[model samples]
Target chain A: MVPISYYLILSGILFACGVIGFLIKRNIITIFMSIELMLNGVNLSFVAFAAQWHHLSGQVFVFFVMVVAAAEASVGLAIIIAVFRTRETLNIDQVNLLKL
Target chain B: MLHLVLFLVFGAICVAGAVNLLAQNHPISSALSLVVVMASLAVEYLLLGAEFVAAVQVIVYAGAVMVLFVFVIMLLNAGAEERTQGSRVALVLGIPGVLAGGLLVAWVLVQRTNTPEVPLGALPGFPKTIGALLFHQFLLPFEVTSILVLIAIMGAVVLASRPEPKMKVPEKES
Candidate 1:
Protein backbone atom coordinates (compact mmCIF):
# COMPACT_ATOMS: atom_id res chain seq x y z
CA MET A 1 0.00 0.00 0.00
CA VAL A 2 1.26 3.44 -0.87
CA PRO A 3 1.77 5.75 2.05
CA ILE A 4 -0.17 9.01 2.20
CA SER A 5 3.12 10.85 2.48
CA TYR A 6 3.91 10.27 -1.16
CA TYR A 7 0.55 11.61 -2.22
CA LEU A 8 0.95 14.62 0.03
CA ILE A 9 4.41 15.31 -1.35
CA LEU A 10 3.22 15.13 -4.92
CA SER A 11 0.30 17.39 -4.14
CA GLY A 12 2.58 19.85 -2.44
CA ILE A 13 4.94 19.91 -5.39
CA LEU A 14 2.13 20.43 -7.85
CA PHE A 15 0.52 23.11 -5.74
CA ALA A 16 3.76 25.04 -5.47
CA CYS A 17 4.26 24.77 -9.18
CA GLY A 18 0.78 26.12 -9.72
CA VAL A 19 1.40 29.06 -7.43
CA ILE A 20 4.68 29.97 -9.09
CA GLY A 21 3.19 29.53 -12.55
CA PHE A 22 0.15 31.55 -11.61
CA LEU A 23 2.39 34.34 -10.43
CA ILE A 24 4.89 34.26 -13.26
CA LYS A 25 2.93 33.38 -16.37
CA ARG A 26 1.95 36.40 -18.46
CA ASN A 27 -0.73 34.83 -20.62
CA ILE A 28 -4.27 34.99 -19.29
CA ILE A 29 -5.06 31.40 -20.21
CA THR A 30 -1.89 30.13 -18.60
CA ILE A 31 -2.82 31.90 -15.42
CA PHE A 32 -6.25 30.34 -15.64
CA MET A 33 -4.60 26.96 -16.01
CA SER A 34 -2.30 27.56 -13.09
CA ILE A 35 -5.32 28.32 -10.96
CA GLU A 36 -6.91 25.06 -12.07
CA LEU A 37 -3.73 23.26 -11.24
CA MET A 38 -3.77 24.81 -7.81
CA LEU A 39 -7.34 23.75 -7.23
CA ASN A 40 -6.61 20.24 -8.44
CA GLY A 41 -3.68 20.09 -6.06
CA VAL A 42 -5.96 20.98 -3.18
CA ASN A 43 -8.45 18.36 -4.28
CA LEU A 44 -5.76 15.73 -4.13
CA SER A 45 -5.00 16.61 -0.54
CA PHE A 46 -8.65 16.57 0.32
CA VAL A 47 -8.94 13.03 -0.99
CA ALA A 48 -5.82 11.96 0.78
CA PHE A 49 -7.11 13.24 4.09
CA ALA A 50 -10.54 11.86 3.45
CA ALA A 51 -8.94 8.47 3.00
CA GLN A 52 -6.81 9.02 6.04
CA TRP A 53 -9.70 9.82 8.35
CA HIS A 54 -12.22 7.38 6.89
CA HIS A 55 -14.52 10.37 7.13
CA LEU A 56 -16.75 11.35 4.24
CA SER A 57 -16.43 15.07 4.86
CA GLY A 58 -13.32 15.34 2.74
CA GLN A 59 -15.06 13.74 -0.22
CA VAL A 60 -17.94 16.10 0.29
CA PHE A 61 -15.54 18.99 0.22
CA VAL A 62 -14.02 17.68 -3.01
CA PHE A 63 -17.42 17.58 -4.63
CA PHE A 64 -17.95 21.22 -3.77
CA VAL A 65 -14.46 22.03 -4.97
CA MET A 66 -15.20 20.46 -8.32
CA VAL A 67 -18.39 22.42 -8.69
CA VAL A 68 -16.52 25.61 -7.89
CA ALA A 69 -13.77 24.70 -10.36
CA ALA A 70 -16.29 24.25 -13.14
CA ALA A 71 -17.84 27.60 -12.38
CA GLU A 72 -14.44 29.24 -12.24
CA ALA A 73 -13.50 27.79 -15.60
CA SER A 74 -16.60 29.07 -17.28
CA VAL A 75 -16.25 32.58 -15.94
CA GLY A 76 -12.49 32.75 -16.42
CA LEU A 77 -12.61 31.62 -20.02
CA ALA A 78 -15.40 34.02 -20.82
CA ILE A 79 -13.40 36.94 -19.48
CA ILE A 80 -10.34 35.87 -21.43
CA ILE A 81 -12.29 35.59 -24.66
CA ALA A 82 -13.85 38.99 -24.10
CA VAL A 83 -10.43 40.50 -23.50
CA PHE A 84 -9.04 38.77 -26.54
CA ARG A 85 -11.60 40.38 -28.83
CA THR A 86 -10.92 43.89 -27.63
CA ARG A 87 -7.13 43.84 -27.20
CA GLU A 88 -6.20 41.15 -29.75
CA THR A 89 -3.76 39.82 -27.17
CA LEU A 90 -3.97 37.70 -23.99
CA ASN A 91 -0.65 38.75 -22.50
CA ILE A 92 -0.95 40.09 -18.97
CA ASP A 93 1.76 42.64 -19.62
CA GLN A 94 -0.33 44.11 -22.43
CA VAL A 95 -3.59 44.01 -20.47
CA ASN A 96 -2.27 46.75 -18.23
CA LEU A 97 -5.09 49.26 -18.46
CA LEU A 98 -6.85 47.62 -15.53
CA LYS A 99 -3.66 47.51 -13.50
CA LEU A 100 -2.98 50.42 -11.19
CA MET B 1 8.18 -2.17 -7.03
CA LEU B 2 5.36 -1.65 -9.44
CA HIS B 3 3.97 1.23 -7.42
CA LEU B 4 7.35 2.91 -7.22
CA VAL B 5 7.86 2.53 -10.96
CA LEU B 6 4.43 3.91 -11.73
CA PHE B 7 5.03 6.75 -9.37
CA LEU B 8 8.29 7.66 -11.03
CA VAL B 9 6.73 7.45 -14.49
CA PHE B 10 3.80 9.67 -13.63
CA GLY B 11 6.13 12.05 -11.81
CA ALA B 12 8.32 12.37 -14.86
CA ILE B 13 5.33 12.84 -17.12
CA CYS B 14 3.96 15.60 -14.91
CA VAL B 15 7.28 17.41 -14.73
CA ALA B 16 7.73 17.17 -18.48
CA GLY B 17 4.27 18.52 -19.01
CA ALA B 18 4.97 21.52 -16.77
CA VAL B 19 8.21 22.26 -18.58
CA ASN B 20 6.48 22.01 -21.93
CA LEU B 21 3.76 24.27 -20.64
CA LEU B 22 6.43 26.92 -20.22
CA ALA B 23 8.50 26.10 -23.29
CA GLN B 24 5.83 25.70 -25.95
CA ASN B 25 5.25 28.70 -28.19
CA HIS B 26 1.90 27.66 -29.50
CA PRO B 27 -1.11 28.17 -27.29
CA ILE B 28 -2.65 24.87 -28.36
CA SER B 29 0.44 22.97 -27.31
CA SER B 30 0.41 24.68 -23.97
CA ALA B 31 -3.21 23.75 -23.47
CA LEU B 32 -2.43 20.16 -24.42
CA SER B 33 0.31 20.12 -21.81
CA LEU B 34 -2.23 21.28 -19.28
CA VAL B 35 -4.30 18.27 -20.26
CA VAL B 36 -1.36 16.05 -19.48
CA VAL B 37 -1.14 17.58 -16.04
CA MET B 38 -4.80 16.90 -15.37
CA ALA B 39 -4.58 13.32 -16.58
CA SER B 40 -1.66 12.57 -14.31
CA LEU B 41 -3.68 13.99 -11.45
CA ALA B 42 -6.42 11.47 -12.20
CA VAL B 43 -3.84 8.74 -12.01
CA GLU B 44 -2.85 10.04 -8.64
CA TYR B 45 -6.49 9.85 -7.71
CA LEU B 46 -6.63 6.22 -8.75
CA LEU B 47 -3.59 5.49 -6.65
CA LEU B 48 -5.41 7.01 -3.72
CA GLY B 49 -8.37 4.69 -4.38
CA ALA B 50 -10.85 7.43 -5.11
CA GLU B 51 -11.87 5.79 -8.36
CA PHE B 52 -15.07 7.75 -8.76
CA VAL B 53 -13.52 11.12 -8.09
CA ALA B 54 -10.56 10.24 -10.31
CA ALA B 55 -12.91 9.38 -13.14
CA VAL B 56 -14.72 12.65 -12.60
CA GLN B 57 -11.39 14.45 -12.54
CA VAL B 58 -10.43 13.03 -15.92
CA ILE B 59 -13.77 13.43 -17.64
CA VAL B 60 -14.57 16.88 -16.34
CA TYR B 61 -11.11 18.40 -16.24
CA ALA B 62 -9.20 16.66 -19.01
CA GLY B 63 -12.06 15.76 -21.31
CA ALA B 64 -14.69 18.47 -21.14
CA VAL B 65 -13.14 21.55 -19.56
CA MET B 66 -9.75 21.23 -21.22
CA VAL B 67 -11.51 21.10 -24.60
CA LEU B 68 -12.99 24.46 -23.74
CA PHE B 69 -9.52 25.74 -22.91
CA VAL B 70 -8.14 24.47 -26.22
CA PHE B 71 -11.01 25.98 -28.18
CA VAL B 72 -10.50 29.34 -26.57
CA ILE B 73 -6.76 29.15 -27.18
CA MET B 74 -7.29 28.50 -30.86
CA LEU B 75 -9.99 31.11 -31.12
CA LEU B 76 -7.89 33.73 -29.42
CA ASN B 77 -5.02 32.92 -31.80
CA ALA B 78 -2.42 34.05 -29.30
CA GLY B 79 1.18 34.09 -30.45
CA ALA B 80 4.40 33.90 -28.47
CA GLU B 81 4.48 36.71 -25.97
CA GLU B 82 7.13 39.38 -26.42
CA ARG B 83 10.49 38.09 -25.31
CA THR B 84 11.75 39.63 -22.13
CA GLN B 85 15.30 39.87 -23.53
CA GLY B 86 16.90 38.43 -20.41
CA SER B 87 15.21 40.96 -18.21
CA ARG B 88 17.04 41.12 -14.87
CA VAL B 89 13.65 41.64 -13.27
CA ALA B 90 12.74 38.09 -14.14
CA LEU B 91 15.77 36.77 -12.32
CA VAL B 92 15.24 38.99 -9.32
CA LEU B 93 11.64 37.91 -8.91
CA GLY B 94 12.15 34.31 -10.05
CA ILE B 95 14.93 33.41 -7.61
CA PRO B 96 12.90 34.39 -4.57
CA GLY B 97 9.89 32.54 -5.89
CA VAL B 98 11.86 29.36 -6.43
CA LEU B 99 13.33 29.64 -2.97
CA ALA B 100 9.90 30.09 -1.48
CA GLY B 101 8.66 26.96 -3.22
CA GLY B 102 11.68 25.05 -2.04
CA LEU B 103 11.00 26.11 1.50
CA LEU B 104 7.45 24.86 1.22
CA VAL B 105 8.69 21.49 0.07
CA ALA B 106 11.11 21.35 2.96
CA TRP B 107 8.42 22.26 5.39
CA VAL B 108 6.25 19.46 4.07
CA LEU B 109 9.10 17.05 4.58
CA VAL B 110 9.78 18.13 8.15
CA GLN B 111 6.18 18.20 9.31
CA ARG B 112 4.99 15.10 11.16
CA THR B 113 1.84 13.55 9.76
CA ASN B 114 -1.14 11.75 11.27
CA THR B 115 -3.63 9.82 9.15
CA PRO B 116 -6.65 7.73 10.11
CA GLU B 117 -5.90 4.94 7.60
CA VAL B 118 -9.25 4.72 5.92
CA PRO B 119 -9.54 1.63 3.79
CA LEU B 120 -10.10 1.92 0.05
CA GLY B 121 -13.79 1.64 -0.81
CA ALA B 122 -14.67 1.60 2.87
CA LEU B 123 -17.88 3.53 2.33
CA PRO B 124 -19.75 0.48 0.97
CA GLY B 125 -20.24 2.75 -2.05
CA PHE B 126 -19.81 6.42 -2.92
CA PRO B 127 -23.40 7.48 -3.63
CA LYS B 128 -24.70 6.03 -0.40
CA THR B 129 -21.87 7.25 1.79
CA ILE B 130 -21.72 10.69 0.22
CA GLY B 131 -25.48 11.02 0.38
CA ALA B 132 -25.87 10.08 4.01
CA LEU B 133 -23.14 12.46 5.05
CA LEU B 134 -24.41 15.40 3.04
CA PHE B 135 -28.00 15.06 4.15
CA HIS B 136 -27.05 14.06 7.64
CA GLN B 137 -24.21 16.33 8.69
CA PHE B 138 -23.11 18.40 5.72
CA LEU B 139 -26.36 19.63 4.26
CA LEU B 140 -25.47 23.28 4.63
CA PRO B 141 -22.16 22.95 2.76
CA PHE B 142 -23.90 21.10 -0.04
CA GLU B 143 -26.34 23.96 -0.32
CA VAL B 144 -23.60 26.56 -0.26
CA THR B 145 -21.65 24.84 -3.00
CA SER B 146 -24.67 24.86 -5.21
CA ILE B 147 -24.99 28.56 -4.61
CA LEU B 148 -21.35 29.05 -5.53
CA VAL B 149 -21.79 27.22 -8.80
CA LEU B 150 -24.91 29.20 -9.58
CA ILE B 151 -23.18 32.50 -8.95
CA ALA B 152 -20.27 31.43 -11.08
CA ILE B 153 -22.63 30.56 -13.90
CA MET B 154 -24.14 34.01 -13.72
CA GLY B 155 -20.71 35.61 -13.68
CA ALA B 156 -19.72 33.66 -16.79
CA VAL B 157 -22.77 34.86 -18.66
CA VAL B 158 -22.15 38.46 -17.72
CA LEU B 159 -18.51 38.34 -18.76
CA ALA B 160 -19.14 36.58 -22.06
CA SER B 161 -22.03 38.86 -22.93
CA ARG B 162 -19.91 41.97 -22.86
CA PRO B 163 -20.52 44.14 -25.95
CA GLU B 164 -18.62 42.90 -28.96
CA PRO B 165 -16.23 45.32 -30.58
CA LYS B 166 -17.95 46.99 -33.52
CA MET B 167 -16.35 46.29 -36.87
CA LYS B 168 -14.78 49.35 -38.48
CA VAL B 169 -16.34 48.42 -41.83
CA PRO B 170 -19.94 47.36 -41.42
CA GLU B 171 -21.01 44.52 -43.68
CA LYS B 172 -21.71 45.92 -47.12
CA GLU B 173 -25.09 45.20 -48.71
CA SER B 174 -24.27 43.18 -51.82
Candidate 2:
Protein backbone atom coordinates (compact mmCIF):
# COMPACT_ATOMS: atom_id res chain seq x y z
CA MET A 1 0.00 0.00 0.00
CA VAL A 2 1.25 3.46 -0.84
CA PRO A 3 0.42 6.54 1.15
CA ILE A 4 -1.83 8.81 -0.87
CA SER A 5 0.42 11.66 0.19
CA TYR A 6 3.19 10.29 -2.00
CA TYR A 7 0.98 10.71 -5.00
CA LEU A 8 0.12 14.24 -3.97
CA ILE A 9 3.81 15.05 -3.45
CA LEU A 10 4.69 13.79 -6.90
CA SER A 11 1.90 15.87 -8.36
CA GLY A 12 3.18 18.95 -6.55
CA ILE A 13 6.71 18.35 -7.81
CA LEU A 14 5.46 18.04 -11.39
CA PHE A 15 3.40 21.21 -11.03
CA ALA A 16 6.39 23.07 -9.59
CA CYS A 17 8.54 21.98 -12.49
CA GLY A 18 5.88 23.15 -14.87
CA VAL A 19 5.72 26.53 -13.18
CA ILE A 20 9.48 26.87 -13.35
CA GLY A 21 9.47 25.98 -17.02
CA PHE A 22 6.63 28.39 -17.73
CA LEU A 23 8.44 31.24 -16.01
CA ILE A 24 11.97 30.57 -17.25
CA LYS A 25 11.39 29.40 -20.79
CA ARG A 26 11.40 32.11 -23.45
CA ASN A 27 9.77 30.14 -26.25
CA ILE A 28 6.02 30.35 -26.66
CA ILE A 29 5.56 26.68 -27.56
CA THR A 30 7.62 25.51 -24.61
CA ILE A 31 5.58 27.72 -22.32
CA PHE A 32 2.42 26.21 -23.74
CA MET A 33 3.80 22.75 -23.11
CA SER A 34 4.48 23.78 -19.53
CA ILE A 35 0.84 24.73 -19.20
CA GLU A 36 -0.05 21.23 -20.36
CA LEU A 37 2.27 19.82 -17.76
CA MET A 38 0.56 21.86 -15.07
CA LEU A 39 -2.78 20.58 -16.23
CA ASN A 40 -1.48 17.01 -16.07
CA GLY A 41 -0.37 17.51 -12.49
CA VAL A 42 -3.80 18.70 -11.56
CA ASN A 43 -5.32 15.73 -13.31
CA LEU A 44 -3.20 13.38 -11.25
CA SER A 45 -4.31 15.12 -8.09
CA PHE A 46 -7.93 14.72 -9.08
CA VAL A 47 -7.49 11.00 -9.64
CA ALA A 48 -5.61 10.51 -6.39
CA PHE A 49 -8.43 12.15 -4.48
CA ALA A 50 -10.90 10.03 -6.36
CA ALA A 51 -9.09 6.91 -5.25
CA GLN A 52 -8.93 8.15 -1.68
CA TRP A 53 -12.62 8.85 -1.38
CA HIS A 54 -14.02 6.29 -3.83
CA HIS A 55 -15.79 8.87 -5.95
CA LEU A 56 -16.32 8.32 -9.67
CA SER A 57 -17.05 11.99 -10.25
CA GLY A 58 -13.36 12.85 -9.84
CA GLN A 59 -12.55 10.46 -12.65
CA VAL A 60 -15.42 11.93 -14.64
CA PHE A 61 -13.95 15.37 -14.10
CA VAL A 62 -10.64 14.15 -15.50
CA PHE A 63 -12.48 13.37 -18.72
CA PHE A 64 -13.89 16.86 -18.88
CA VAL A 65 -10.45 18.30 -18.21
CA MET A 66 -9.03 16.24 -21.03
CA VAL A 67 -11.76 17.48 -23.35
CA VAL A 68 -10.95 21.04 -22.45
CA ALA A 69 -7.23 20.41 -22.84
CA ALA A 70 -7.68 18.99 -26.30
CA ALA A 71 -9.77 21.96 -27.35
CA GLU A 72 -7.25 24.32 -25.82
CA ALA A 73 -4.36 22.65 -27.60
CA SER A 74 -6.02 23.07 -30.97
CA VAL A 75 -6.90 26.71 -30.51
CA GLY A 76 -3.68 27.57 -28.74
CA LEU A 77 -1.53 26.06 -31.46
CA ALA A 78 -3.45 28.00 -34.07
CA ILE A 79 -2.89 31.19 -32.12
CA ILE A 80 0.79 30.31 -31.86
CA ILE A 81 0.92 29.87 -35.63
CA ALA A 82 -0.64 33.29 -36.17
CA VAL A 83 1.75 34.90 -33.73
CA PHE A 84 4.73 33.29 -35.39
CA ARG A 85 3.58 34.51 -38.80
CA THR A 86 3.41 38.12 -37.69
CA ARG A 87 6.36 38.39 -35.28
CA GLU A 88 8.64 35.87 -37.07
CA THR A 89 9.90 34.77 -33.66
CA LEU A 90 8.82 32.39 -30.89
CA ASN A 91 10.56 34.13 -28.03
CA ILE A 92 8.07 35.45 -25.49
CA ASP A 93 10.12 38.52 -24.60
CA GLN A 94 10.33 39.60 -28.23
CA VAL A 95 6.62 38.96 -28.78
CA ASN A 96 5.77 41.69 -26.31
CA LEU A 97 3.84 44.18 -28.43
CA LEU A 98 2.00 45.76 -25.48
CA LYS A 99 5.00 45.84 -23.19
CA LEU A 100 5.06 49.62 -23.10
CA MET B 1 4.98 -4.60 -2.62
CA LEU B 2 4.74 -4.87 -6.39
CA HIS B 3 2.25 -2.03 -6.52
CA LEU B 4 4.59 0.21 -4.57
CA VAL B 5 7.50 -0.64 -6.88
CA LEU B 6 5.51 0.03 -10.00
CA PHE B 7 4.18 3.29 -8.63
CA LEU B 8 7.63 4.55 -7.62
CA VAL B 9 9.24 3.60 -10.94
CA PHE B 10 6.62 5.26 -13.11
CA GLY B 11 6.55 8.27 -10.84
CA ALA B 12 10.30 8.66 -11.23
CA ILE B 13 9.99 8.38 -14.99
CA CYS B 14 7.24 10.97 -14.99
CA VAL B 15 9.38 13.37 -12.95
CA ALA B 16 12.43 12.78 -15.16
CA GLY B 17 10.46 13.45 -18.32
CA ALA B 18 9.15 16.68 -16.85
CA VAL B 19 12.66 17.81 -15.89
CA ASN B 20 13.92 16.93 -19.35
CA LEU B 21 11.13 18.99 -20.86
CA LEU B 22 12.48 22.00 -18.99
CA ALA B 23 16.13 21.23 -19.73
CA GLN B 24 15.82 20.71 -23.48
CA ASN B 25 16.73 23.75 -25.53
CA HIS B 26 14.78 22.94 -28.66
CA PRO B 27 11.01 22.96 -28.88
CA ILE B 28 10.93 19.57 -30.62
CA SER B 29 12.89 17.93 -27.85
CA SER B 30 10.68 19.53 -25.25
CA ALA B 31 7.63 18.32 -27.11
CA LEU B 32 8.98 14.78 -27.16
CA SER B 33 9.75 14.98 -23.47
CA LEU B 34 6.19 16.04 -22.84
CA VAL B 35 5.03 12.95 -24.70
CA VAL B 36 7.14 10.81 -22.42
CA VAL B 37 5.70 12.53 -19.40
CA MET B 38 2.18 11.97 -20.63
CA ALA B 39 2.86 8.31 -21.32
CA SER B 40 4.21 7.74 -17.85
CA LEU B 41 1.25 9.61 -16.44
CA ALA B 42 -1.06 7.14 -18.17
CA VAL B 43 0.72 4.33 -16.41
CA GLU B 44 0.24 6.19 -13.16
CA TYR B 45 -3.45 6.49 -13.87
CA LEU B 46 -3.64 2.77 -14.55
CA LEU B 47 -2.02 2.10 -11.21
CA LEU B 48 -4.79 4.04 -9.56
CA GLY B 49 -7.28 1.82 -11.46
CA ALA B 50 -8.61 4.51 -13.79
CA GLU B 51 -8.15 2.23 -16.76
CA PHE B 52 -10.29 4.25 -19.13
CA VAL B 53 -8.66 7.49 -18.15
CA ALA B 54 -5.26 5.85 -18.57
CA ALA B 55 -6.07 4.79 -22.10
CA VAL B 56 -7.49 8.18 -22.94
CA GLN B 57 -4.41 9.84 -21.46
CA VAL B 58 -2.21 7.83 -23.78
CA ILE B 59 -4.38 8.35 -26.85
CA VAL B 60 -5.62 11.90 -26.53
CA TYR B 61 -2.74 13.48 -24.66
CA ALA B 62 0.39 11.56 -25.62
CA GLY B 63 -0.77 10.74 -29.12
CA ALA B 64 -2.88 13.61 -30.42
CA VAL B 65 -1.81 16.65 -28.40
CA MET B 66 1.92 15.98 -28.67
CA VAL B 67 1.64 15.28 -32.40
CA LEU B 68 -0.15 18.60 -32.78
CA PHE B 69 2.65 20.33 -30.89
CA VAL B 70 5.31 18.70 -33.08
CA PHE B 71 3.44 19.59 -36.23
CA VAL B 72 3.16 23.23 -35.20
CA ILE B 73 6.86 23.32 -34.33
CA MET B 74 7.75 21.97 -37.76
CA LEU B 75 5.34 24.29 -39.53
CA LEU B 76 6.66 27.35 -37.77
CA ASN B 77 10.23 26.18 -38.35
CA ALA B 78 10.88 27.33 -34.83
CA GLY B 79 14.50 27.35 -33.83
CA ALA B 80 15.78 27.21 -30.29
CA GLU B 81 15.06 30.51 -28.66
CA GLU B 82 18.06 32.30 -27.20
CA ARG B 83 17.96 32.80 -23.48
CA THR B 84 17.26 36.41 -22.73
CA GLN B 85 18.15 38.55 -19.68
CA GLY B 86 14.55 38.43 -18.56
CA SER B 87 14.50 34.64 -18.68
CA ARG B 88 17.71 34.51 -16.65
CA VAL B 89 16.23 36.74 -14.00
CA ALA B 90 13.06 34.71 -13.96
CA LEU B 91 14.97 31.47 -13.57
CA VAL B 92 16.92 32.91 -10.67
CA LEU B 93 13.78 33.98 -8.84
CA GLY B 94 11.16 31.51 -10.02
CA ILE B 95 12.95 28.26 -9.25
CA PRO B 96 13.15 29.01 -5.53
CA GLY B 97 9.61 30.29 -5.43
CA VAL B 98 8.21 27.20 -7.10
CA LEU B 99 10.31 24.90 -4.96
CA ALA B 100 9.18 26.60 -1.77
CA GLY B 101 5.58 26.48 -2.76
CA GLY B 102 5.74 22.83 -3.77
CA LEU B 103 7.60 21.88 -0.61
CA LEU B 104 5.09 23.67 1.55
CA VAL B 105 2.19 21.87 -0.07
CA ALA B 106 3.85 18.47 0.14
CA TRP B 107 4.80 19.01 3.73
CA VAL B 108 1.29 19.93 4.63
CA LEU B 109 -0.21 17.00 2.79
CA VAL B 110 2.31 14.43 3.94
CA GLN B 111 3.26 15.38 7.50
CA ARG B 112 0.03 16.91 8.69
CA THR B 113 -2.59 14.57 7.31
CA ASN B 114 -3.49 11.13 8.65
CA THR B 115 -4.76 9.91 5.31
CA PRO B 116 -4.67 6.15 4.90
CA GLU B 117 -2.57 4.27 2.40
CA VAL B 118 -4.26 3.30 -0.83
CA PRO B 119 -4.05 -0.25 -2.07
CA LEU B 120 -3.67 -1.15 -5.70
CA GLY B 121 -6.72 -0.76 -7.91
CA ALA B 122 -8.53 1.37 -5.42
CA LEU B 123 -11.53 1.68 -7.73
CA PRO B 124 -12.27 0.08 -11.05
CA GLY B 125 -12.59 2.67 -13.83
CA PHE B 126 -13.98 0.52 -16.60
CA PRO B 127 -14.99 2.16 -19.87
CA LYS B 128 -18.60 0.98 -19.60
CA THR B 129 -18.94 2.50 -16.15
CA ILE B 130 -17.36 5.80 -17.12
CA GLY B 131 -19.42 5.96 -20.32
CA ALA B 132 -22.63 5.51 -18.39
CA LEU B 133 -21.57 8.20 -15.96
CA LEU B 134 -20.76 10.58 -18.79
CA PHE B 135 -23.92 10.02 -20.78
CA HIS B 136 -26.22 9.94 -17.79
CA GLN B 137 -25.15 12.09 -14.84
CA PHE B 138 -22.84 14.38 -16.83
CA LEU B 139 -24.95 14.40 -19.97
CA LEU B 140 -25.29 18.12 -20.44
CA PRO B 141 -21.61 18.87 -19.92
CA PHE B 142 -20.68 16.11 -22.33
CA GLU B 143 -22.94 17.48 -25.04
CA VAL B 144 -21.64 21.01 -24.41
CA THR B 145 -18.05 19.83 -24.76
CA SER B 146 -18.83 18.36 -28.14
CA ILE B 147 -20.01 21.78 -29.28
CA LEU B 148 -16.87 23.28 -27.78
CA VAL B 149 -14.73 20.88 -29.77
CA LEU B 150 -16.63 21.78 -32.90
CA ILE B 151 -15.99 25.46 -32.32
CA ALA B 152 -12.33 24.76 -31.63
CA ILE B 153 -12.01 22.94 -34.93
CA MET B 154 -13.48 25.87 -36.82
CA GLY B 155 -11.41 28.40 -34.89
CA ALA B 156 -8.20 26.50 -35.54
CA VAL B 157 -8.92 26.33 -39.23
CA VAL B 158 -9.68 30.01 -39.43
CA LEU B 159 -6.69 31.13 -37.40
CA ALA B 160 -4.11 28.93 -39.03
CA SER B 161 -5.16 29.54 -42.61
CA ARG B 162 -3.01 31.95 -44.58
CA PRO B 163 -4.71 35.08 -45.82
CA GLU B 164 -5.71 35.04 -49.49
CA PRO B 165 -3.38 36.92 -51.84
CA LYS B 166 -4.73 40.23 -53.11
CA MET B 167 -5.95 40.43 -56.73
CA LYS B 168 -3.58 42.30 -59.11
CA VAL B 169 -5.15 45.43 -60.63
CA PRO B 170 -4.73 45.94 -64.43
CA GLU B 171 -2.23 48.60 -65.38
CA LYS B 172 -3.81 51.77 -66.87
CA GLU B 173 -3.23 52.31 -70.65
CA SER B 174 -1.11 55.37 -71.52
iRMS of every model, one decimal?
A: 3.0, 1.3
Best-fitting candidate, scored by lDDT: 2
lDDT by residue for model 1 (A1-100), tens? 4566666777777777776776667778887887887887788888877777666677778777888888889889998888887887887777769732
Model 2 C-alpha lDDT per residue in residues B1-85, reported as the tens digit of each score: 9889999999999999999999999999999999989999998889899999999999999889989999999988889879787
Off by over 4 Å in 1: B85-95, B111-125, B162-174
Error of 2 at A31 (Å): 0.4
For residues B86-150, could you state the per-residue lDDT of candidate 1 as single tens digits? 33565688758777877877676668554333333433226666678878798888788888888
Among all windows of ten consecutive residues in candidate 1 chain A, which has the lowest summed lDDT? A1-10
Q: Model 1 lDDT vs. the true structure?
A: 0.75
Q: What value does the lDDT take at residue B59 in candidate 1?
A: 84
How far in Å is the alpha carbon of B65 misplaced in model 1? Answer: 1.9
Name the weakest run of 10 consecutive residues (lDDT summed) in model 2 chain B: B86-95
Tell me how candidate 2 scores on lDDT.
0.90
Error (Å) of candidate 2 at residue A96 is: 1.1
